[model samples]
Target: MSKICGGIFTSHVPGIGKAIAQNLQNDPYWKPFFDGFDPIHRWLAAEKPDVAVVFYNDHGLNFFLDKMPTFAIGAANEYRHEDEGWGIAFARPFQGHADLSWHIIEHVVASEFDPVMCQAMTVDHAVAVPFELCWPGKDAFPTKLIPIAINTVQHPLPSPKRCHDLGKAVGRAIESWGGNEKVVIFGTGGLSHQLEGERAGHINVDYDKFCLRNLAPDPEALLQHDTLDIVELAGSQGVEILNWIAARGALTGSVRELASNYHVPISNTAAATVLLSHSERVLA
Candidate 1:
């Protein structure tokens, strides 16, 4: 059976990708944020997971307001990255694990979660930036990818509890797959920041800290807040933490934080990276 190695939760601010493309990692403005990935680099080197199942939000590259699925999973042979007007150089296309993608799609649907299944998908920075952060200086990402997009771009988004439940369902599906591939789950986007409105440029350090503290050990504690509450506290875009919650929910094992970094004002968002290791499946 396939084994889930662990999960990585991080912010996917577009500027990070620009900084990386420009080779600005050691610059004073970018050092702290860039340094956070050191431990993650080491962990990836050691684990060498064969597949990466990414949970991220699409930023107008794949879906728009007229039509967006609450959940979308890719069953493509490969996923291409395109210019999203961010001016960041396009990263190479990522190879896909179509067999595993179909398996997850089938399993989740059987578990009563309806999702859009894509045979071909275009990934935006939400998917590319995290892969770059985790494995820098690579021509192509080492692991085959399965991109699962959640709707954070429109109203009536999935609630925290619902996202968490989806993650749990995905975890079960991964473990039950009849393959020996080692997999890593990625939950990408947001610590806290709003890009527009009167609350624009808002960064809630206290709230971000609260989330970072509880997310790994007691994700249930976060379910206490509804989606509206999150928007109010973390800012409209900050609600992207829903991705983090889902990623955490997927770790159906005894989990412990191996490394974490939280820094403020990275492109006006609270930039954070967390690397968690899972041991022994905790039967659902």
Candidate 2:
């Protein structure tokens, strides 16, 4: 059984993760976030976690409206970065964690959650951007990654209950994996930001605050409310909480908030960042 398991919650607002990485290295607004992540970085630097199972959704950037996978697992050797409808593309190609990834796929299959396995997958900003923030250097962050792809941008996304079930299965698989000591799970996405219609630039500081508060302790309350209800309360794109629910489930113990940051009216969306870890290795 794996000895240690934890989670990192963050915002992938375009270049936001990169910005935080810089803050860890320098900037003022980002220092707290960077500081909170320091133990994580140190843990990464020391334990050299063998596997990192990351959960994120794909926008239209990689999968389009015509064909979308509710859940996809990339068993590829490498992943390329792409644009989010913007002219600019992220510069690096992300490396995949193949061994553990395949292990996870097979484990999930036996457990009855059959995810589509892709030998070669191209990830968009949704996955790449936040990763850039979390692990700035490709050569840094020692673990191989298992990318859990969720679809939130397209219409008719998966329900909260479905995502929650997936997380439970992920926890079971990780617990079953006969592995080394280190493992980190990440759920990357939003805290109440809408990216469509005149509702663009919508600021629900109240909703965002509620989410940040509830994310750790009362997640079920958030989950109990329907996805449509959350979307209504949190704007369409705001339904990204499904990703976090899965991350929350993957963790071994209670959730602890280490650091948090929120800013509003950035381009067409409200932006925020949150860093959380499982309760156990609080000192690490």
Q: Which candidate is the best by lDDT?
A: 1
Go through the candidates in order and give each one's C-alpha lDDT.
Answer: 0.91, 0.70
Please write out the lDDT profile of model 2 over residues 203-250, one tens digit for every residue.
577877887788777666667767788788777877887788778777
- The pairs that clash in candidate 1 are none
Show model 1 residue runs off by greater than 4 Å. Answer: 87-89, 282-284
True lDDT of residue 13, candidate 2: 68
Q: Which parts of model 2 are misplaced by more than 4 Å?
A: 17-47, 84-87, 137-141, 265-267, 279-284
For model 1, what is the C-alpha lDDT against the true structure?
A: 0.91
